[model samples]
Target: DVKVTQSSRYLVKRTGEKVFLECVQDMDHENMFWYRQDPGLGLRLIYFSYDVKMKEKGDIPEGYSVSREKKERFSLILESASTNQTSMYLCASSSSGTGGSATNEKLFFGSGTQLSVL
Candidate 1:
């Protein structure tokens, strides 16, 4: 079974402070993603790394950054936390696909991290 572990289940911080959310996946998947879920915006991808040391920006990359130093680890960094940044953050991992029809593979997700900035 694939397991995605998020370091924090809940976090609270005041505005202007820096925040770091960590995620680790046991499976040696080639793709890892970070997304933030909001009521109206839905799940917006922040960043994703297809391979170690290779990262691509997603739709909402502003105010966020990601690091994939190892195959099993990916981290999301918030330079300066703000009230508007408060949301439910999700980390997911999935393989590039084996057979020819692997493009539709499902992504395994972590429980989630709810961040609140005052």
Candidate 2:
């Protein structure tokens, strides 16, 4: 089974502090993504990388950044944490192939990290 593991299931930090969230996938998938899920706004993509050392900014990248130094690892960074940045962060991976196991490929998700900024 494809597994995505997150470094932390929960995190707490104070405002103005820097925070990091790490994620690793075991399937050797080529695409990895970081998303912040909010109650009414839904899942908002923060960053994604299709290849090693290559990354693209998502819809909400203002307070977030991502690093993909290796094929199976992706990291999310919060430069200066704030109370408003508290949210559920999710990491997901998908195969690079056009179709994986079926006509449409499905994304495998990690358990998610709940970050609280005080």
Candidate 3:
């Protein structure tokens, strides 16, 4: 079975501290994504990588960045944490489908990291 593990399930940080959210997938998936879930905003994509050292900016990438140095590991970096950035951070991985399209791929999500910024 495919498993996605997040380093932290709950976290609290100061407003200006740098936060690192780590994720690792057991399966050799080619795509990894970072998403933040808010009360009314739903799941907003922050960053995604299709391959190692390759990253694509998603909908809300202003305050975030990602690193995929290995096939099974993806890290989300919050350069300067802010109050508004506090939310549930989720890491997901999916294997590329027939044409490398994600439309039909099954996503495996981590338990999630609930970050509280003060």
Candidate 4:
């Protein structure tokens, strides 16, 4: 099975500390994304990388950034944590091609990281 593993399942942070969350995929997918999910706001993308050392800012990139130095790994950075940033952080990976399995072509998600900023 294609698996995406997140660096954390839960986190507690102070108001202004920097935070780092890592994600890795075993399938070597070409697309990696970071999103924050809120109760009613749904998922908002923070950043995405299609290749090593390359990144594209999604709709909501403010106060957050990303890095992908290797094909199988991606990292999200919260420049300064705040209470508003407290939410469920999700990492997703999508293969470059649809291939044979339509269901598997969609994004595969990690368990997620819940961040609580105090």
What does candidate 1's lDDT look like per residue over 34-80, in tens digits? 99999988899999999999999999999998888899999999999
Worst 10 residues of 3 by lDDT: 95-104
Tell how far residue 101 is off in model 3, in angstroms: 8.5
lDDT of each: 0.94, 0.94, 0.94, 0.93
lDDT by residue (1-118, candidate 4, tens digit) is 8899999999999999999999999998999999999999999999998889999999999999898989999999999998999999999999877667766558999999999999
lDDT of 3 by residue, 18-60 (tens): 9999999998999999999999889999999999999999999
TM-score of 4: 0.93
Q: State each candidate's clash count.
A: 0, 0, 0, 0
**TM-score of each predicted structure versus truth:** 0.95, 0.94, 0.94, 0.93
lDDT per residue (tens digit) for residues 2-96 in model 2: 99999999999999999999999999899999999999999999999999999999999998888999999999999999999999999999986
Query: Once superposed on the true structure, which residue ranges of model 4 sit more than 4 Å away at CA?
Result: 98-104
lDDT of 4 at 49: 89
Residue pairs whose backbone atoms clash in candidate 1:
none
After superposition, the stretches of candidate 2 with alpha carbons farther than 4 Å from their true spots are: 99-104
